[model samples]
Target: MTFQVARMNEQESAAWLGLVTVCQLLPAALDSQLKQDSGMTHFEFSVLSVLRFAPDHTLRMTALAETTSSTLPRLSHVCSRLEKRGLTDRFPCPEDGRATNVRLTPEGRNALVRAMPGHIDTARRLVVDALTPEQLDALAQVTAVIRGQLDDGRPARGNPFA
Candidate 1:
């Protein structure tokens, strides 16, 4: 028996390289912007955004981890930082005494609110405005297809990586 590797064609290689580059650079760029403007990382901003939309601005720790695509330890560390900054609080989950829940505090909400303008501007400058309307639509569809492939049975959302 022989093992063979199928190499990507020119177009496929370009696409793959572009995707990899975007994956590598985009987060760092966004993280840098968020840290400069809001004193938070992109992941932290994501956590606050998730909690802000959650019921009563709260979510069980596990749920938060899933929603944010984080491990429990990472979530716990980020939560601790957020808690220290008065952005969020962790406490016993009311429905389950054994589990914990994190709540977005008023300070957290305000911080998110304050962070939005600069974040949106950065997003526009880096991505949104860089594409035409057609390109944006195409990008969304292409990304959804890629995410669907990567996530398997998981639900889809707007550029979870971003």
Candidate 2:
């Protein structure tokens, strides 16, 4: 396949650039705040949080990866780091010898307890507080549409460049 530059004017190109910038920048901003204040990267925090909410404070490693939208290798690496920190433990699954389960350690729970309020505050300040009720609803709708399109194996609507 060959690609060619579209005939977008300078203003349209600038807007596209801005969209890409925000997508990259927002996560970095959140991660910086999270690391400085909580000593956890966003991905680490997400993994810990999901485990924290699992039944019996444990989940199959594969299930954890699915919930976190992470690949198995990536999640395994993160789990290894957390294990080294004494925040989690992995054991063979009770019913399936081929599978492993990850559980939050007491220390991990403590860390998450300490970190959640700050994370929630940052999220509220950066996103929730800035949006009106209607904007939030619209944002949800837009994202859901995109997600549904991807899930349905179809091209998304409304954005030609998507």
Candidate 3:
């Protein structure tokens, strides 16, 4: 099969460039802040935070991967690191021998709690507080549409703010 690529016009090119720039820079900034303040990467913090809010602070590894938008191998690597740090534990799911589950340790929860303030402050400084209320709502709506497109119309799991 062959397809022709539609060339982006100047306005579309500018918008695309802006989006790409934000995508590239935002994670690094967040990662830097989290690393310096809490000794965790943004991905690690996200993993722990998701588990922190999960029922019984546990989730099947597949569910955790979906929640974090991570691949299984990447999640496994992160989980291994977390386990070594005593932040999480991975075990075979009791209901399904072939599946794995991860639970947040008390240390993980404490790390998340400690990380929150700096994370929120950085987010606000970089994105949230920079936008007006109307802009914030519009940003949410725009991103939701784009995310839906990227994810084959599937809504993202769980409360993003949580």
Candidate 4:
């Protein structure tokens, strides 16, 4: 027997649209909230959080940019802003004079301490509270699938090549 192809109905269309909406909207919402509540943009928050986990709360600028998925120029601009706020320190790397290192200053740590609670609350409100346990598990699995495909030289399941 041959399979009959059918077009997606309105409900299917709505679900597809909703998934896109959540993906796009949630980050913007979180960024706005973080900026309003903590004076930190989400990108800036990511940089700070990454540095927080590094040894002595420092990382080479190139490494920091990579970890944050940012370009050096963009990271440098953010670093400059953070520096103005006295939240970070930038110095030439002692081990490699040609490289630069960024470190979280005491004030930066304090800012992160204050901002984290609000950021967590916002994340919960926008994401965690909205997902069921089953959905969360599914999402994790789906994300892994996508990442695996990216790493394994395979197209994702939906792609014709895969």
Q: Per-residue lDDT for 92-145 in model 2, tens only?
A: 999999999999999999988898888888888887889999988987787787
Q: Model 3: how far is 52 from its true place, Å? A: 1.0
List model 4 lDDT by residue over 42-88, tens digit each.
Answer: 88888888888888999999988867767999999999999999999
Across 1-162, the per-residue lDDT of candidate 3 in tens digits comes to 999999999999998999999999999999999999999999999999899889999999999999898999999999999999999999999999999999999998998899999999999999999999999999999888898898896866775433
* lDDT for model 1: 0.91
Q: State which candidate, 2 or 3, has the greater lDDT.
A: 3
Worst 10 residues of 1 by lDDT: 153-162
Kindly report which residue stretches of model 4 are placed more than 4 angstroms away from their true locations once superposed: 1-19, 149-162
Top TM-score hit = 1
> Which ten residues in a row are the worst by lDDT in model 2?
153-162
Ranking the candidates on TM-score from highest down gives: 1, 3, 2, 4
C-alpha RMSD of candidate 1: 1.8
Q: Report the poorest 10 consecutive residues by lDDT, candidate 4.
A: 153-162
Residue pair clashes in candidate 4: none
Count clashing residue pairs in model 2.
0
lDDT of each: 0.91, 0.83, 0.92, 0.84
- Residue 28: error of model 3 in Å? 0.3
Residues 1-162, model 1: lDDT tens digits = 999999999999999999999999989999999999999999999999998888899999999898887999999999999999999999998789999999999999999999988888999999999999999999989988987897896885433325
lDDT of 3 at 17: 100
